[model samples]
Target: MGCTTSRYATGKKKPVPIREIVVFVPSTRVPKEIDLRRPLRGSLSEGLLERLAALRAKVVALSEKWSLNCSTPTGNIATED
Candidate 1:
């Protein structure tokens, strides 16, 4: 008989150690081996407010689209007791 390669229609696997195992726990993680720098400009960041204001519409739209129920201390999202 000719030598046949391993693994056939019978779905048999050679005796080998299983390596694909992943365990995830909902626990906090700490940053490691990385560098983060501050803003390139000085303290008085120019045009930052305007840029954020421009994104407000998009953020609200996305929040409604995803049904996130996002609420903040703003007019449309916020409510007072």
Candidate 2:
């Protein structure tokens, strides 16, 4: 992604010819999901729903492991903020 040549130039002198370089990154249209239930229905889109479900499954698995590792008064844990 580059070009080079001899006889370079510097400031206060003739400017060196410039070559352009470009980098590319691949991206997908995958969207993020946020869970919402009754009493507070979420504006979840179809694509987002799938992503949310996958994320929820992960959290459940992690919570199970964490609960076993550290027992506390609250059987499960939650965050208010």
Candidate 3:
């Protein structure tokens, strides 16, 4: 018998039919990483590059603040009067 055939005659449990499952996952396109050590090469406008740098600085500041808050001992702080 062919491999696809069920093995009912061998007194064994019949093999389950193979099924194809297609899952469609929606995802956002992420930009490729740019090496900050080197200068950017493109026709990108200077204004846009400045804006990006400002945003990066803001992100770094927020990250530092988050780390400081997390490192503090929350249990030792009195929450109520």
Top candidate on TM-score is 3
RMSD of each: 18.0, 18.5, 16.5
Instruction: Give the alpha carbon lDDT tens digit for every residue of 1-81 in model 3.
Output: 223543353666776443433334333233344544237537556777777877776766666676666555454433333
Better of 2 and 3 by TM-score: 3
lDDT of 1 by residue, 1-81 (tens): 333343443555554333333343333332242212234235535576456545665665665644433332224433334
Q: Considering summed lDDT, which 10 consecutive residues are worst modelled in model 2?
A: 21-30
- Encode model 2's per-residue lDDT on 1-81: one tens digit a residue: 545554446544565544443434333222344444432346656677667677877777766666555443344444344
| Candidate 2 colliding pairs | none
lDDT of 1: 0.42
List candidate 3 stretches off by more than 4 Å.
1-38, 75-81
Candidate 2 is scored at a TM of 0.34
Residue pairs that clash (backbone atoms under 3 angstroms), model 3:
none
Shift of residue 13 alpha carbon in model 3, Å: 49
Candidate 2 whole-model C-alpha lDDT, 0 to 1:
0.53
